[model samples]
Target chain A: MDLLYQIFVDPFVQMGTAPDLLVQTLWEGLVSGVLYALIALGFVLIFKASGVFNFAQGIMVVFAALTLVGLYEKGVPAFLALALTIVVMLGLAVLVERLMLRPLVNQPDIVLFMATFGLTYVLIGLGEIIFGGDPKVMIADQLYLPRGAIDVNMLGGFVSLQKIDIAAAIIASLMVAGLAVVFQKTRIGRALRAVADSHKAALSVGISLEQIWVVVWFAAGIVALATGIMWGARSNVSFALEIVSLKALPVLILGGLTSIPGAIVGGIIIGVGEKLGEFYWGPLLGSGIESWLAYVIALIFLLFRPQGLFGERIIERI
Target chain B: MRMKQLALGVALAGIMAAPALAQNSIFVPLLTYRTGPFSNSGIPIANGMHDYLAMLNERDGGIGGVKLAIEECETGYKNEKGVECYEALKSKKPVVVNPYSTGITLALIPKASVDHIPILSMAYGLSASAQGQDFPWIFNPPATYWDGLSMIIKYIADKEGGLANLKGKTIGYIYFDGGYGLEPIPLLDQLAKDYGFTVKKYPVPPADMQNQSGLWLNVRRDRPAWMIMWGWGAMNPTAVQEAAKINYPMDHMIGVWWSGSEDDARPAGAGGKGYLSLNFNSVGANYPAIQDIQKYVIDKGNSQTAKDKVGDNFYNRGVMNSVIIAEAIRNAQQLTGKKEVNAEDLRRGFETLKITPERWKELGLEGFAGPVNVTCTDHNGHHAAYVQQWDGTKWVKVSDWITPMKDKVQPLLDAAAQDYVTKNQPWPKRTEACDKSS
Candidate 1:
């Protein structure tokens, strides 16, 4: 009976986060949610295009950011290094088209995903060779990111929000909107969507699958680069960046792989939900529940919804 | 047939070469976490180890002109991989093992006792390793979690003017949910029982601590007078930010040595100003050893850290770990007469080490931790620590070196170590190795 009290009843009784503290806690969750969503955006972009989960997306972020920083450190100007990183990502896209995608065309999705696992290792080794293994503080000051926070009055309380976080949220929303416009309105976007819908049908329609693969991958690479720079500014850029990227798995589950809107909404929900959960309920369990909270939430969502909030309902032909 | 003949021939040649090759240099097995979540900190440490060996070779022509050989196997913080690395390297007759992870060190404790290989778990590993009589082969120089926790509690007590003032005051503890974070719990509990403070604990889960509302909300709700944190890696930054969010005064927060780093501070730069953490070694753009590191390690392009990131707290600790290993080997050479000594020789070296203030100054570590004097009964050679506050941009020393309640801590170390032995059913044989005197 005492054990039961310790396990369940005692936890809630101890809850006493003040109103101001509650608002601030929610703000942290919202900020972290944005970052998690940014990482998941890259995975969703690739998964939607190729039907192959890009395991190397996380490393790509680290690798791209590291390359940019390393080149800048080598006396190359920041803007120039950023340009060169784009080129590197493009070169990588071309290399993937020629070496991986083209060669393994028509392969099973599992095979393609496994090949990405191989790619992750290759990038890790290559990145380490090109840029030595070490964590680097992002050039936030150089990148001109706003530092410090603004205290806002709310619910007879106050909440502090970093200016850079606001900028990130704005930029991420724009980028997603831009991608949606490109996919819906632009010729290349339609071709890519066609390829996503039916690779055989897209080929029959005379769309050069090779061109679409290169273009979509290069676009994903750009997303990865942006995600890297933003997250790297939060902490030092290092191989550890890869671990942070793994948080996207729960985000992807919450947001369906096939639905872009799902990724956006799901990422925010997981991010905000985990924070709120940690703030409100973490004390009951002795804290540290935020890590697994997203997966637990996603699992529960799966049980009820089956399809994600915005995802298409499956109609099995069988 | 040809493959078999060639393999047999190669095996025979290797066996023949083994006896012909003289073992003049000591082999130190490095169990490094150079590719894990901790690698942000570990890579620099491994680089420090390598550069110091290079420095020895460059400056002294190698431990009395016999040279030092170091072979590192990357563990990435996996205990099983660390054990595999230890097994793979032990056959090479290593002088000692310096495993960077607490998990790995715990795994190696039994292996070290059985294999006769001494381990140097500096400022890490099991908190009870300070009880050298029980832990025959383990050396935790410059205190343990118990020592660090006492120092913080002592400082807090001193600030409050008396132990009695702690009554009804809640003390918050946010620690990682692992053995490394758990080490200070027993000591904290004892102090709370004695001091009449209500203890509130919040455990940070690993790799998933970015959103830490659960922990920080608890601190705000409890309204603790002070918070002591024992966290590492992502846990540090997240905890700091969460604390800042809940408007917890960063100045009243205390972190253990492992949790305090430039990387850890930068994320919470907004709310982290004046956050105090214990420092066994001071770090910054200053420090003479950092000059040696920049000149020898980074300049040579052999540094494991970015050239700009040198002199950061964890990077300096990496350099210090290498210094400890090198100094031990140098001390071993004095007693053993052999230029290259084995694990037993290094054990004696660690036991008899007398790194005075002058030696530290000469080694370009004038202000790092004043001095470390090793003894058989006390494996933690140095018991002194000072407080450093992250002043938004850098770590600045805020207090003189203060020794914790050693009289109170020693008995706890002894008792816990005895419990470890009894639970593990280790033999009651006395570790007479301390008396061998080479």
Candidate 2:
């Protein structure tokens, strides 16, 4: 009886008594969800265009962020550093297309996936050699990112929201809206969707697979830069940020690997679910449940819809 | 036939390299992690250790006329790679091995007795390994996690007016949930019971170290009067940032020594001011020994240490570690009456090692660390540690060396050591005995 009441009655009662804290928790959940969504968006862009799981997306986030900061530290102007970082990302996309994806174009999906694994190590080694393995402060101040928190009185208490978190949510929404426009209205968007449907048919229709690959990879690189900046603003920019990229996998599973909107919705679900689970139900299970709760939520969702919520249905003619 | 010829050639090369290894030097292999997720802290510590040994080789011609041959085998702070490095370097006949991470230290504890090599974890391994009877081959000198925890509790008690004032007050503990981070739980639990205080535990998994809004939100909900952290690497800075976000008083929050580096607080800028962390070694390059290290190692461009990180907390802590090891070598040489010493001789050296004030002055590290004295029964020297406050730019010492509650901590250590021995049956028994001097 005591266990039952503690499970069902206590958390709700606590929420009622301290609505301000509840608001704070929900806001935090939303902010983290948006960041996770951004990372998932990177994975979705590449997967949608090329059917290859880019394992290096996480390291690319770190590498892009590190390059921006490292260049700024070397006396380059902040905006120039930003522009140079974009050029570097473009070069990276071209290099990946020419060296890795081009040779393995006709191979099995697993081969391309394994190739990204090699890319992950190469980037790690190169990043360390160049950046010297030290955590650097993100150029948030130079980039005009906000700081401090805003406290508002509500529900007979105060709720604090970080200014940077608010900015992140806003910037992420804008980026997502921009990507949606590019995918739906642009000529490259048609070719991308056509290739995503069937590579042979798209090629027969005069869409160059190589050109589409480079564009999608460059788009993913931009998403990675946005993610690195937002997340690094919250924490220090270091190799440890790579691990947080794994959080996007569950988001990918929940949102559908090929659906951009699915990535956002899936990210919010995992992020909010993880926070609420850890805050209310985590004590019952000895805490640290946040580490695996997102995966479990994604797994349950997969059980109901094997193709994911926004993913296209698979209809085989065999 | 060609493959066999190649194999024969490799065997001949291996045989020829054996005699060259036994020439005139003492080999000490350092299993370090200078590149990885933990490299933010690992690089400085590795640089300190490397620079100190190099200083010895350059200035004094090594300990007692034997050149110190220091080799580094990078483990990248992974347990599997640590074990691999151990196996790879064990054939080199190193006098002692310093497994930097607690996971690697635990892995090597059982192997050390069989291999007849001593393991020196310095301030960060299993708290129960301090019991010399059960863990005869492993040494965590200067202090243990239990010691560090007791000191923090004592300091908090003193600040709160009295130990009785802690009753009914909730103290929160946020830890990394790994072997090293979870080490102080039993001691903290025992202390809470004795003091009548309530303890709330918040664990941060390694995967979620950078994403700890959930933990801090819980912190806000619980509203504990004081919070202590057992975090490392990237977790340190993130936790500090979250605490600042929730407007937690930086003075009321404290971190363990591993979480006290400049890297931990520099990211937060001024918001991290007044944050407290317990430290065993002094920070700064004002010491004569550090000056020698700069002149001999860095100036010559023979060191991998960054010029700016010469006197950082973790770097200085690394130098302190080498000081203990080098002094032990000197002690062993004096006792054995030989220029070169073996692993068993190093063990005896550790048992009888003493870092008195006079010795510190002689070694040119007069005020760098607390005096350490190791006995046969106590692998941990039970030395006191000081609390330092982050003053925005650097850490400044704010308190004297505060000793742990030995009376309260010893029984727990003994019981834990016994429990470990009972669990790992057929554990080796200690055959050597010495006088108690603490």
Candidate 3:
């Protein structure tokens, strides 16, 4: 009975008693949700265009960040390095189209997935060779991203909000809005949606699959760069950042793999849900459940709604 | 017939070349990880370990007239890979094996006696292995994790006035969720019980090292008076940054030796000031030995180390690791009177090894680290460690060397050792005789 009370009754009581702590946990969860959604956005863009799960998305984040920092360390101005990094990502998108996708075109989805595995290794080796294995501080000051925090006193206590986190939330929202407009209102967006619907059908209608693939990959590259900067500012820029990208897997599953908006909602749900679970209910299980709690939530969502919240349902007659 | 003859001829040639190469050199295999998530920390230590031995080979013509044949096998900091490296290198008859990881050391402990190789975990391994009587083949010099934990507790107690003053205070411990983090928990819990303090744990899984905001939120809620961190690699900076973000007092947070590095602190920027961590070796390139390393290794372009990172904390720690191995080799040569020492001879040398303050100066490493003396009954010296505070830019020594409470630690260590032997029944008793001088 006491265990039950501690399990169910205690967490809500604690939440009710300390509204400040609740707000802080929710804020952290929301910021983390935005980052996870950014990574999931990258996955969604590529998956929508190519129908291939890019296993290399995680390493792409590390590579993009390393390029930015490595170039800056080599005496390139910060803004110039950022521009060059974007150009490099474009070059990478072209290279992937020419080398990996074109060669293995029309193959099984698993084959393209395996190719991405190879791509992950290649990028890891290249990044290490070029940037070395040391962890580097992000150029947050040079980028003019805000630092420190703003503490709001409320409910007889204070909730501290990091300024950089606020910037991340703002930037993530703007990017999502811009991408939504692009996907809905532009000719290129129409081409991308048509390609996502059917490659052979889009080709029959005179759409260039190759061009669509490059554009989507380059867009994903931009998202990865944004993510790398935000995450790097939070921690250090290292290959270790690649592991955090795995958190997006749950977000992708929770948000439909192909729905951009679904990615955002799923990211927040997983992020907030994970933080609240670990904070209020973690001591019951000895803590450290944040790592797997997101996946567990995703699994539960999968059982309930096979197609994610914002995903379009497909119906086929047998 | 021709193919068979060719294969036989090549095999015979290889057999002839093996002994010829072994006659004039000593092989020391290093288990390293240079391409994993942990590689950020591993790379510097690998470079330092390699550079120090390479310097010896270049400057002094190797230890005791025998060229030191050092080979590194990448383990990626995984235990299974570490065991595979051990299996692959055991055929080369290495004098010693430095696993560089606690999980790998735990996996190799049982196989050490059967394989006739001494495992040098070097301050990071099974803390009970410090009991030399129960485990003769494993040596962890300088200090064990439990010893380091005890010293950290003592430091905190001193700050709070006394151990008795810690009665109502709650101490938070954030640690990596692995053998290296868990090894000191028994002692920490015992100390907490003795002092009437509550211990709240926050374990960081390897994958969640960077995603620690939620954990820090809990820290804010619990409001522990002090936070002790036993973290490594990316976990250190992330924890520090999150603590700073939550406005946790930086001075009240302390990290273990593994968590203290330029790579760890520099990433947190100015927010990381006053964060204290324990370290055994002195930092910087000012010592004569480190200067020699720069002169012979880095300046000559023979090392992978960056020019500016020559005397960083982790690099110096790696140099200290090699210094122990080199000293043991010299001691073994003197005792056995052999130019090429085998694994067993090196084991005896490790058992009787001693590095006095005078010897440290003689080795051109004056005041670089504490004096280490390994005896027959005690493998780890359990030496004192000092606290270094990160002052936003660099580490500054903040306190005198604080020794472990042996009276408290010894009983737990002995019981742990005995429990280990009972669990792994048929464990071999110590049969190797100690050196007379030891």
Candidate 4:
């Protein structure tokens, strides 16, 4: 009864008493959710177009960030380096599509996934060799991202929100909206959907599968670059950032694997839920519950809706 | 018949020539991680470790006239990989093995005596390994984790006026949830009990290191008067960033030695200003030994180290590690009168190791590090460490060298060591005789 009281009643009481901390925790969760959504969006783009779960998406974020920072460190201007990084990502999309996807086209989906695992290692090795292993400071100042925090006095206390986190949330939202516009309205979007539905059928209808793959991958690369900048600004850009990408798996499970809006909603839910769980209930469990809480939430979601909150439903006539 | 004879003869010749080739240089295998998550910290240290030995070979023709064959096997900071590297390299007859990771050092401790090679963990590994009577082949000179923890407490006590003033105060500990981070907890808990303070624990799992917003949010809620971090690699900078975000007092927050690096602090930028961490080795390229390393190693295009990172914290740490190894080799050479001393000879050197202030100057390392002494029953000398504060750019030493409370620490260390031996029943007894040279 005491344990139950501590679990169910005490947390709510604490929440009521310390509303400022609750807001801070929620804000942190929202920021984390935005980042998770950005990474999941990259996964969504590739899976939607190619039907391949791109394992390389995580390393791609690190690689893209490293390229931008590496170029800037080599004396290239920040904006120019950002442009070159985008170009590099485009070139990478072409290279990956040509070398990895084209040959493995019409092959088993697992084969494509395994090929992405290989790409992850290749990017990790290449990033280490080119940038050297030291963690590079992201050029947040040069990129005109805000520094410091905005302390708002409310709830009888102050809630400090980092300016960079605020900027990141705005930027992530804008990119997601832009991706939504492209997917819903553009001709390329129709081609990608056609390929995602049925590759052979799309080919029969005169859609170039190769072209769609590159375009979708390039789109995913753009998402990854945006994610790398925001996450890198939050921490330092290093190979370690790839591990945090695993957080997106739960997000993908919560938000449908192929749905854009689902990604955003899923990210926010998992993020906020985990933060709240960790903050309120973590002490009872001796802390460190934040690591596994997202997966637990995802597991509950899986039990109810394996297709996720917004995923397409399938029905068999047989 | 001719083909068979020639193949057999070549094989015989190769077998005969192998030992001869090994005899010309001293083999030292560095279990390093230049890739993976910890590479940012590992790379600089790897370079420093490699560069110093490479410098010795280039400048002094190696310790005692034998060129040191320094080789690095990448562990990527994984325990299994570290053990694998150890197994693969142990056959090379390496005079000493420096398993940089605490987990790896723990894995290698039992193998050390059996293999007849000294394991120099260098201020890390099992804190109980300081009891050299039990862990004769394992040397973690300078200080142990328990020592460092006590010193941190002592430093805190000094700042707060007295030990009595710490009563009713709460101290938060955020640590990497591993053997390395967990090593100091028993001592810390004891210290908390003795000092009348509450200990709030935050264990950062390896996976959750980068995402520590939840951890810091808890900190903000708990409102601990002081925060102590035992973080490493990416966790260090992220913790610093999160702490700064929650408006935690930067000066009140302190990290262990591994958590304090340019890589750790620079990412946090101006927000990490006034953050404190402990250090045994002095920072900067001002030391003559460091200049020699730059002159013979980095300047020669031989070292993989960047031009700017010659005197960075982790790099200097690696250099100091090699300095101890080199000193051990020299001492072994003098005692055994062998140019290329074997592993057993090196073990003797480690057991009888002593470096005074005069010796520090002689080695071109004046004021670069505190003096280290490893005795027959005490491997780690439990030296004093000073506090260094990050000024947003570089570390500035802000305090005198503060020694650990050895009277309080030694009892705990002995009990822990005894507990380890009792648990591992078939633990080998120390049969190696003490050297008369000591």
Candidate 5:
């Protein structure tokens, strides 16, 4: 009874007394949640159109950012280099469509999914060879990211929120809202949803499967580029940033692959939950809970709602 | 096809001008990581390696009039790939290799001896390789793992008056769960037992660092006087911030050299004020070699980092690494004529290297490193380090240089290394090269 009081109830009692720590924890969760959603948006864009989970999306984030910085360093202007990077991403999309998707168009979902694992390696090798294996500073000054922090004094304690983190949360939310509109209101978006429902059925009804995939992949690349630049600025741009993409995995499992709103909510829940767990209960288990807490959260959620927050019930047919 | 042709052309060119290009040339195998969780650290180190070599060629027309050849193979921090790199480069007749990882060094020990490749692990590898007879081809200049751990205790001991003062005090050890991390556990445990200090262990999962409340809560409850971290990658800054959240004394907490680089600084920059660390070499803004690197290399736009990052911790460490390797090769050329040097020649060269204070001033690496003596039975060229504290913006040197407790470290190293041999059972074939004079 004493141990339970110490482990489970003590942290909340402290939080209740010091409401400021609770508020600060929430803010940290929101900041991290925004980043998670940003990564999930890339997954959502591709999955919405092609029903394919891009296992290479994480590498794509590193690849796009590396290419842009690498080209600019070689004397190309920043904006022009960004344009060139867009062209490269488009070229990559076309190559994927031709070499991978087109050949496996009639293949099962598992086959297409397996193909992405191979594509991840190809992007990694090509990125390293062309850019030289080095991390680069992101375009923080040129891109005009906010600098410094906003100190807030609340409930007898003070906490700081970086201006850049605030800017990121706003931009990420706006982008997600814009994406939601595009999916719900645009004709191309409707065609994408149609194709995602059944590829053969959409093809038979005169939808151009080829064009929709290109557009969806291009959008996914753009999302990756944006995440890369932001995360790179927050930290240094390195191949290590490749693992940040995995942070989105639990977000996917919790939010459901199909629901956009679910991604946002799930991201925030995981983010806040992990932070709170790390702050409160982590020491009891020996700390370092932030790493695995989200996966465990998603696992427990799966036990109850296997279809996820907004995913349709998975049906089996003989 | 193109690379094969290029390799052949380079090799043929070497043979054709064999005498002229002989012992003067320094060949270095750079086992690098371009991909993986640690790439952020690896890439900059590679850039520093390449940039320093370039500067040597440009500033001095190469060491002793022979250019340096730094061949890099992307290992991504994997032991198997590192072994493959060693196998591929063994026949290059090179003198030394900088493997850049502790696990990789452990794997390369047998091969380094078998293939006659001298390894310069700097401060990032197997601590026992510091024992020269058992590890003739391995060299770890500056501090080793035990050195880093002992210094942290030494700092604490001084504050409390003596080592015996630590009795009943709790000390925390939070680390990534791996060999590179667990390398210091036995030493720490022994130290705790010797001093009667209580020890707490917190094991972090790989590639992620979100929750540390469990460990911090214990710290709050137990109130350990100091926390010593042995971690890598994102774990460093993350651990620092987690400690901060729990209000652990940032000044009292110390990270090992690997965990104390600038890459670990920026994330918790402001939040981790007064965080202290043990650094093997003095690699920061104040080093003279850094001014040269900035003016000659970075200012000339040959840097792998932003121009301003020239004097950062990892970058200066890079410069220091280049300085040691370059000097070793320079020393090797004396016994082996500049035209006929090989692995054995380089080993002899390293054995005689003595980088004095005067030499450091000349090389412009003055204040960043200490005097180094490399000999047949002492593969670790030096074993001195200083404490530095982050005053928010940059790392400021706090203490004069400190050496590990030799009585404490030597026995632990010998015992552990001997165990490694006994566990492996079959001894590796000798890595010694036949000396013409002998």
Candidate 6:
């Protein structure tokens, strides 16, 4: 009975007594959720278009950030460096399409996925060679992102919110809204949807599968650059950031691999759930639960809805 | 066929060239990681180690007229690859092997005995390996993790008036959830019991190193009077940032030596001011040995180190490590009367090594490190360390060298060493005489 109360009653009572702390924890969860959502958005874009799970998406985040920082270190203006990074990413998309995707066209999906794994190693080596494998301070101030924190007095206590996190949340929302417009209203959007439906059918209807692949990859690279900036602002920019990409997997699974809105919702659920578990109930289990709680939540969800919350339902006929 | 004859001839030439290569120098394999998540810290240290040896070669024509052949095998900080590097290089008959990571040190400890190579782990490895009676092949001189933790507690006690003032306070320990990070736990727990304090532990998983908001929030809620961290790599910067965000007193928060690099505090910018960490090495390039390295290696563009990273903490620590190894080699040569000493002679050199104040002055390393005298029974030497604080720009020594609580730490070391020996049954007994001259 004592153990049960500690498990169920104590956490809620603590939360009630310290509402300010509760608010602070929730805010942190939401900010982390936005970052996870951005990374998942990148994965969803490429997967929807090519039916390939690009394992290189995480390294692409590191590569994009490294390129920006490396160029700036060489005395390039910040805005010009940002522009050049985007061009480099676009060139990378073209090169990847030409060198890897073009040769392996019409191959099995697993083979294409394996090709992305090869791309991951190549990018890791290239990034290290160019950037010299040291952690660099993010050029947040130069980029004009907000610094410091704001403390709000509410619930008879103070809750602190980092201004950079608020900025990241706002930027992530705008990007999602802009992506939604692009997907819904553009001519290229229609072609992308047609190709996503059936590559051969889209080709037969004169959709140009190759062109759509490049566009989708470029879109994913842009999302990666945005994520790299926000995350680097939160911490330092290093290859260490590559490990955090693993956190996006549960977000992708929960949000459904094919849905943009699902990625955002899924990210928030995992992030908030993970933080809450680590804070309130973690002491009961000796702490360190944040590392695996997101996956556990996704695994439980998988039992009931393997198609995920926003994934398209699959039908099979015998 | 003619192709087979050509292949045979090439193989024969390689075999014939092997002895010539061996006769030219002594091999010292460095298991280093220059590209990985840990590379931010690893690169500087590896460069320091490499440049020091290069300096020795350029200035002194190597130790005793034979050039020191330093071969680097990249492990990327992974234990499996570290073992693979060890296996690949053991055949070269290296005089000593420096396994940089604690994980790799733990993996190589048992194998070093069979391979007859002395494993020099510097200040980080299994603390119990200091009990040279049981583990003769592994050496971690200058200090051990237990020594580091005891010193931290002593410093806190000194600041709080006395050990008695620590009775009712809550002390938080934030550590990485790994063998290396958990090394000081037993000593901390034992000290807490003896002093009547409450101990709170917060573990940062390897995957969660960069994402530590939850852990910091708990620290705020617990309201510990002080916090000590056993973190490395990306975890260091993140922990400092989160602590600063929560308005934790930077001076009251301390970290182990691994967490004290410039890479750790520089990311936090101005918010990282007054952060303190323990140090077993000097921090600047003012020493004569360092100046020689700069003149001989860096200025000549013979070093892989960046010019700006010359006086950094981890880089200087790496140079200190090489200083220890080079001294051990010189000691072995003087004792054996042979320029090329084998692994057995190097082990004797480590057991009887002495780096006194006079020797430091001679080596042009005055004020760089405390004197380290490794005895037959005490491999760690129990050398003292000082506290250094980050004063916004760089680390400055804030306290004199404080000795560890040896009376309290020795019994724990003995028990842990005995536990290890019992677990790994049929462990070799130390049959060699301690008083024998090489």
lDDT (tens digit, per residue) of candidate 2 on B1-438: 999999999999998886666768999889898887788878889999999999989988888988899999899888899999999999888899999999899889888877889999999888888887788778899999999999999889989998999999999999988898889999999999999999989999999989999988888888988999999888999999999989899999999899999989988877899899999898999889999999988999989988889999999988998998898899888877877998888887888889998899888888888889987878998889999999999999998889989998899989999998898888888875553332
Worst 10 residues of 3 chain B by lDDT: B32-41
Q: How do all the candidates rank in terms of DockQ, highest first? A: 4, 2, 6, 3, 1, 5
* C-alpha DockQ of every model: 0.40, 0.82, 0.80, 0.84, 0.31, 0.82
Off by over 4 Å in 4: A315-318, B1-17
- Predictions in order: lDDT: 0.78, 0.90, 0.92, 0.92, 0.77, 0.90
Isolated chain A TM-score, each model: 0.92, 0.98, 0.98, 0.98, 0.95, 0.98
Q: How large an RMSD does model 6 have?
A: 1.8
DockQ category of candidate 2: high
Per-model chain B TM-scores are 0.92, 0.95, 0.96, 0.97, 0.89, 0.96
Candidate 2 interface RMSD value: 0.9
Root-mean-square deviation of candidate 4? 1.9
Candidate 1's residue-wise lDDT over B182-205, tens digit each? 888998999899889989888877
Please give the distance, in angstroms, between residue A123's alpha carbon in candidate 2 and its true position after superposition.
0.3
What digit string (tens of lDDT, one per residue) describes model 5 on residues B1-438?
A: 999999999998888887555455667778877577677667667777777777887777777777776678888888888888888887776677878888888888877777677888887678887776677777887767888888889888987899999999999888877778888889999999999998887777665533343345445555788888887765676577667655678988888877776667665646678888887566556665566556677777766566666666776677778888888778777676674356777777776777888898888766557888776666675477888888887788898788789889989888877877777667563355433331
RMSD of each: 3.8, 2.5, 2.1, 1.9, 5.5, 1.8
**Model 5 — TM-score against the truth?**
0.80
Query: Per-residue lDDT for B30 in model 5?
Result: 80
TM-score of each: 0.90, 0.97, 0.97, 0.98, 0.80, 0.98
Residue-by-residue lDDT tens digits, candidate 5, A1-318: 988997879998978877766777777778778888788878877886777898999999989889888888898888888899899889888888888888888787788888889999998888877886655667766667775678788898765576766887888888888877888899987888898788888899999998888888887887788778777666556676777778899999998987889788888888888877876777667666777888999889989999888777879897
DockQ, cand. 6: 0.82
In order, the interface RMSDs are: 2.8, 0.9, 0.9, 0.8, 4.5, 0.8
Q: Count the backbone clashes (under 3 Å) in each candidate.
A: 1, 0, 0, 0, 18, 0
Error of 5 at B317 (Å): 2.2
List where candidate 1 sits over 4 angstroms from the true fold: A1-25, A315-318, B1-22, B209-223, B237-247, B266-272, B282-312, B334-337, B358-368, B426-428, B431-433, B436-438
Clashing pairs in 4: none
